[model samples]
Target: MPPATATTPAPPTAGATDRPGATGAPGRAVQVTWAVATIALVAVGTVRAAGWLFALCLVAAAVTGTLAVTGGRSPLGMLVAATLPPAATVRALSWAVRGLRDTRPAGAGIGVGRILKSLAISAGLLTLFGLLFSSADAVFADLLTGLLPDISPDGVVGWLLRLALIGGGLLGAAYLVSRPPDLEGLRPGPARPAHRLEWTLPLVLLDTLFAAFVLVQLTVFFGGAGHVLRTAGLTYAEYARGGFWQLLAVTALTLLVIAVAARRAPKTTRADRLLVRALLGTLAALSLVVVASALYRMQVYADAYGATRLRLFVTTVELWLGLLFVLVGVAVVRLRAAWLPRLVVGTAVLALLGLALVNPDRLIAERNVDRYLETGRLDVSYLSGLSADAVPALTRLPEPMRVCALGQIAAELPRDGLWGTNLGRERARRDLAAIPTTTGVTDCPGTRRW
Candidate 1:
């Protein structure tokens, strides 16, 4: 008789499981590709100039790439997994590292040792020639000396640590792709049956509370400044400052509650589905009222104070939260939209890109300058601390204020001749240099500090 043939199970796709080593050759190939891409992203992000936009872009890329490696099939699932608290990543990393023990050898060799030896030989030749030329010519010696790295113990350790971190992160990502963690919780599972009465009672109670809150917001929102002062018994600035952040926090928490309730709620029957929609829709609508209140309060606060970067960020967050609630409403209407997660992520990415395009530093500077024109109180100290992008806007201020602003700005502007300067810094330097110095601003106290 013929020998019995053994059967090997295929690797898991989206909503399945694969034993260790069952991922096969294709999975390993994908792992290598994703690892290379992740490392490249991290390297570019690290070397790029530091800014809010650069940091945001780096984070977005790194996070999305990590999620893709984590076995998320749908864009929505990947995006959701990406935003999950750091605990999820830590768990996934731990599992990936543990899975390293199960790694099997490939049936091939790449002769990496030979490649390393060749690279070492080439480096040695280059070093020998460099040293010979430096010894023969003083200019060459200085140039080579400037180019040579200072190989101190601390420097070496730091460089090694950086390399290790990059290597380890890449390895971890590759391991995840090859052996994905058992994260059933992160998967988009079928909606479980929820008891209609069980969900209805709590949702109704929450809905009633939200309704009361909306009524109060309507009074404050439509009644104008006088109503706020009359009901809250505080000045507009005081009321604005006290209520906006609290309302924002409340709205955020409410959103979380609604999301959790809807996700866990059973919708087996038609009545259950309708009930879920009605409850979530009502909550979303009330949340919008709260969002509007938060925005209005922030506007009032910004009008009273000035538009700082922090305030602008909060305003953006509130707006984004409002958009999220709108998306939630849509999801409720559709009932089983797997596309919601992707929509949320896309909305967030667009918002972040919009913010980067707006250029917060310049926006803050311009708005502050306008505020100074109206109130005659330029926060010279604050303006000085802004990034180089604010220099042109600062030039628009009055003579002494302009001089003060430019002087403080010039202190931080890039002074490294021209070899390594960026366009933004160079532009700022030229604009500052164009400001003709006058004796009047010399008496300004802030200019003295500059």
Candidate 2:
């Protein structure tokens, strides 16, 4: 100090270092890779008809983009992560706009305007030269024609609009990678616990109601179709259909009730935790029975008629709801649910992906075909109305039925370019090509049962 000694400043404290935006920018390689992946996925998946590949690719692109921007960091609460995308996207867009308005380069990197200007100039020059060169030579022209996509005048505007949207989205996501948002800040604080009787009484009453419903379902299950006809004064199919919708509502409402009850229930003491577990666990268990009953009803209905898209979709939803009940049961047992939100979201995503992979339209067609084989009744009109995904199964039908079932789908099949190519469509086209073309089928035979 006497010699005016220069001292190194103390390093920033851990708390300061861990603050939002304190982490350095995401790596350049990561940003570039994410941009390419997102653009390619959206372009390829959506440029064509949406199918299983599109579904899978869309999810992948969203996850990749989210991870890229946040530097692979996720919130402790997965529910928080689930709600972060819209807010994060808005914040990123705002940051990007601010960046563009800044005169100086951020850090040692090129300024946003400069980079954008360079890109525009390069693109213009490349397009101009490429066009001129193509005009100068036939061989070169053919090569370029093959290499470049042929966008018609009518479609050029649409294509450009898609490009603009994709580009804007990528820019926002890229900036987010460079400056990760404070995800931890988005986590919600714990809820206030309700009074012991406040939560307990409602839950106990709900559980009792669920118990009564479950007992009635057991009676119905044991008594079979005869009892349903005798009591309900309707055919088993009608009874099943009516009961399914109501049971589905019950399952959904029960889940909501459980969520609200769990949030407000006290768990500070052993007695309170035990009571919570017993009440909520009983409710979840009864809800599972309701889910089963709903499924049984759907099975009865589908067997009476045949599987349709709506039937299959609702069945899947029911199954997912059943799984949610199981998950809630697990959470009830553990008395801690910090992991439940993420697991719930993950299972839903998996369920959707599973549906896509199974090819629901094809499954519906196949089930109906099986039913037709057994009962000698086919809904040719319904089969014909399905997407290309049903074509392969529809081809399995006999004679005029096959022709009628496939005629609309075959007529509607578009000759997709490289970007528009889809697995289901490709399979349909190939299957159609393999079969002999049949004509003169005026109308389908069967009427829709639904």
Q: Pick by lDDT: which candidate is best?
A: 2
Work out the TM-score per prediction: 0.73, 0.80
Error of 2 at 207 (Å): 1.3
Relative to the true structure, candidate 2 has a C-alpha RMSD (angstroms) of: 5.5
Report the Cα lDDT for residue 354, model 1: 65
lDDT of 2 at 43: 54
Displacement of residue 158 (Cα, Å) in model 2 is 3.7
Between which residue pairs do clashes occur in model 1? 194-266
Write the residue-wise lDDT of candidate 1 on 1-450 in tens digits.
999998998765853335321245654453354445445444433333226656666676566566446534354446554654354445556665455434345654434444456889999999999989989999988777666654679757866896776566565565555555543344566667567677789889989998898888788767887877887689767888888889889888987787777788877789778888999899998899889989988898777777777788889889999999988888888886565765665566567656665767788889988887887766687777787778878889887777777775676664432234455566777887787634456555332111
Judged by whole-model lDDT over C-alpha atoms, candidate 2 comes out at 0.75
| lDDT by residue (tens digit), candidate 2, 146-196 | 666658885688778868766666665675557666654565578899999
Any runs in candidate 2 off by more than 4 Å, and if so which?
1-102, 105-108, 132-147
lDDT values for all models: 0.69, 0.75
